[model samples]
Target: MKNHYCVIMSGGIGSRFWPASRSSYPKQFLDFFGTGRSLIQQTFDRIKKIVPVENIFVVTNQRYNELTLEQLPELKPEQILLEPCRRNTAPCIAYAAHHIHAINPNASMVVAPSDHLILKEDEFLNSLSNGLDFVSKHDVLLTLGIKPNRPETGYGYIQASHQSLDGFTKVKAFTEKPNLELAKVFLESGDFYW
Candidate 1:
């Protein structure tokens, strides 16, 4: 797994979860489920199962540096790439990719949010390992998605073919937060994942 890397994106203001999550203390640092570990810690645990601890990097806002270190003491100080400012996901990812490339030129990375809660962690890890393997040998970008239980406006949706292709389906298009009407239609179609 030396060639594998994981990038955790934890810089979002988490405005959607406002009133509870503010700029100084975002949702990723909170333990909403009272699990002792914060959301980002949980994410790190999950990713570390597949990727080596040293190979995992966190790309968060510079402000969260102390909080991140306090929570995840297992990581080296260099593992955290604090952004001077929040420029959104694309730039955050690019920044992480650039830094990680300097360390491992032929690395394959799995980029994920720091607030996700997975119930079936073993299954999720298995799927992630498979995706990492698939991407390592092919010059392609593969997205791992969850089967949405609800039409959540907070996430992007992937539209795929109904026909399964070797346990995978072809992606038709990506839909931004669709209205309730479109979301219901997508649910009925049985091919949209968030």
Candidate 2:
């Protein structure tokens, strides 16, 4: 997996989960589940199984640089991509992508949020492996979508076509946070995943 890389986006202020998660210390730096590991730390551990620890980059705000370093001390200065300002995920990803491409032009990256909780780690790893394999041979942007078990308006949804090739489906469109009624339709149609 020499060409594989992981980018963990950890710059959000996480205002929704306030009090427990504040601007001084976002949710990504906290061990909210009593797991002994912060959300970013857990994400690093999980992704390292597929990509080398050295190849994993954490993109966070300049304000949280110390927090990230404190949580994951093993990270080198270069591995921590400090954002001068919060421009959201796209720019954060572009920064990392440019850096990674400069280092390894053949790099295939898996960009993930730092504050996600994965209960089925083995399955998640398997899916990641499959995604990596798929991208290695194709020039396409791939994203892992979870079949919504509930009408979770908190997350975005991907509408995929019925076509499935090598366990990967063709993404038709992306819809962000549909209302409860539309969410139910998406769930009932079995065509959407968040």
Candidate 3:
């Protein structure tokens, strides 16, 4: 449906990536694995299958406006929202939400980062379809997550209720990058998702 929209967040400078990812050209714009398509382009190709090209928007820093166009020429200049300064994720999401909501009052949006690499396309898209359907029907905030499948300390973990309402678990608490011991505790409890 035209009411379905996607907002791709691509404003980060990606300093952690260092040599490969510079301020001028961050990781999102680089073809990390020789995929021909850059990370952001890969992200766009996946989302465009579900959301209309016109309905999809990219939120990036003002400096990357031209770079975004160079990479995603299908999107009109207006579809790219440029931030004069970096205000991080919350503000960036709010900015995109305000614009999308104003254009279509009934718009259902999926806000995603530009750097995530998902290997299973069919499964991811299927889950995305379900999440979008669930969000469109109710006035609620929804996010996709997978149960901890590996030992990792860098991911943020969400503790969800044992019960499920309408096929969605209620998030009880969130722990961002817990220590190794805490991560093990979550892995054992079996109620946390990363």
Candidate 4:
């Protein structure tokens, strides 16, 4: 099978992270996990193992181009995509997808946040491989949805379908950030998370 590609989106302001994530230094460049490596560097290295280093792209704002390059030296300057303005995730992703498709039409791209915490390396890679394999054979949008843990009102949630085949859960609907009560119900129901 052809190798998959990964796009690390690090242009976010990270308002929730607060004072720790300043305008000069965003959360993606912070060592949130205390793993010695910054989030952006960790993300770049993690995807490198699965995808060719050249195939991995870092999409960010024009201002942070130098910071992204300094953190991820493995990535070429050209590989770091820069956005002229901040619109939203959808537009950023759409622009990136189109740019990448123009270069490699067969590429299977995985869009991931630069600040997420992944404890299980093997499991994460396995899931990614599955997504790539699925995308290669079928024309579908692949997303890795995590299960919810507690009644947390911070993150959004995705509802998975009843059908379960080949260890992949189907997505039903995506729920925006909910109130504490609704979040508690979601957690107790044991449906999904992100």
- Clash statistics: count for each candidate: 0, 0, 0, 0
- Residue-by-residue lDDT tens digits, candidate 1, 1-194: 89999999999877888988888899999988998988999999999999999999999977899899999999988999999788988899999999999998889999989998899999999999998887788776788877788767767899987665447666889998888878888877888898
In order, candidate lDDTs are 0.89, 0.92, 0.91, 0.84
lDDT of 2 at 176: 92
Tens digits of per-residue lDDT, candidate 2, 104-158, equal 9999999999999999999999999989999999998899998999887777999
Name every residue pair that clashes in candidate 3: none
Instruction: Write the residue-wise lDDT of candidate 3 on 1-194 in tens digits.
Output: 77899999999897989999999999999999898999999999999888889999999988999999999999999999997689998899999999999999999999989999989987998888788888889888887888898757999999998777699988888898999999999999998899
- Candidate 4, residues 169-193, lDDT tens digits: the string is 7788888888999888888887776
Candidate 1 lDDT: 0.89
Model 2, global lDDT: 0.92
TM-score of each: 0.91, 0.96, 0.96, 0.92
Residue 160, candidate 2: C-alpha displacement in angstroms: 1.1
Where in model 3 is the C-alpha error above 4 Å?
none
